[model samples]
Target: MKLSPRMQFLVRNGLKGFLWLTVLLAAYFLFREVVITHKPDAWVERFYARPMIIYLIYCFSEFFFGLIPPELFMIWAINKGDTWHYLFNLSLFAGISYLMGYINFLIGGFFYKNETFTNLKRRLLKDSASQVKKYGIFLIIVAALTPLPWSGVSLLVGSAGYPSKRFLKYALFRLLRFAVYGYIVYQTHQI
Candidate 1:
């Protein structure tokens, strides 16, 4: 059976996400084995020492187009090797990321008519805007689950006047992404 265009898109992006995850985990293993072996405790200590700073950076990244991948944070939590604490931190990270996306959506709606924002939307979302319009909330699901810029897509959806209720419903998949990735990272760390 032939897959529909949407299904093809989803399959292609899903494979990309899986590939990216594999590369990330491999890099993490190389770094941990080669570099961190010398001072493992020291590195983990520093991460634990400045919890607020790390969280703040994560918040900023999530709000500003996901500058850093969330998997890195999951790796950090895995380094600590406290399952319950890691789960708690993962939840917090997902919450903060979700909140940031919502904030960006609100900002996009409130400033949709502003010249500066219009220019930004044009420049930053040149391709994404068209995709979002074509795919509707399916694109939102893609962004939430894959490596796409979640905040940018959220902003575009809001500026395009998509309903808030539907957006919220679709965006809940973001949490599932976190949970799945967190579990994978945790399991990978075991190896």
Candidate 2:
């Protein structure tokens, strides 16, 4: 017997769902084992507990954005405590990162309005324009996922006069990327 296209699509998605569930379960077991066997690092907790240090790290890291992978901070947060703290750190990092990206977008807009910077912007972002056109918002999500310089992409898209609403809408995926990557890193990172 043959299945309809819709049925085939559903079956494929169902299988994918099951596979993900299995992988997640295995990861949970591994994480639990690690937590049980390893003692939490006192210095890591001390460093994480310092609000001034965390603020400095957040500012500097956000300034460096793509240059400095945010995973280091994410790992630090995961080491801070349990799942709730990990999730809080994910949201914190994502919010700060998104704010920086928005600031970069505003800077891009400023460059767009200036003739000298506008020419330079065109030269630098010429290729990205085509890529953005081809892939639309998915390109932004891909950049975010790969831990690439999403601020750069944000700047380029903003300078190109991509609709502000659409840019904001698509950029929200940065939060999801942070959450997903934070979870994986939390589960796998040795305490």
What is the TM-score (0 to 1) of candidate 2? 0.66
lDDT of 2 by residue, 67-117 (tens): 556766776777777888788878888998888877877776776688997
Q: At residue 71, what lDDT does model 2 achieve?
A: 69
- Distance (Å) between predicted and true CA of 134, model 1? 2.7
lDDT of 2: 0.69
Q: What TM-score do all the candidates reach, one by one?
A: 0.82, 0.66
Tens-place lDDT per residue, model 1, 1-191, is: 99987778777877786787678668878987898898978887877678888899999999999988898888877776588989999999999989999988887777776788779878887776566566756777888998788898898788865678888999999999999989888887874
Error of 1 at 174 (Å): 0.6
Lowest summed lDDT across 10 adjacent residues in model 2 is found at 9-18
Give candidate 1 misplaced runs (Cα > 4 Å). Answer: 115-130
The TM-score of candidate 1 is 0.82
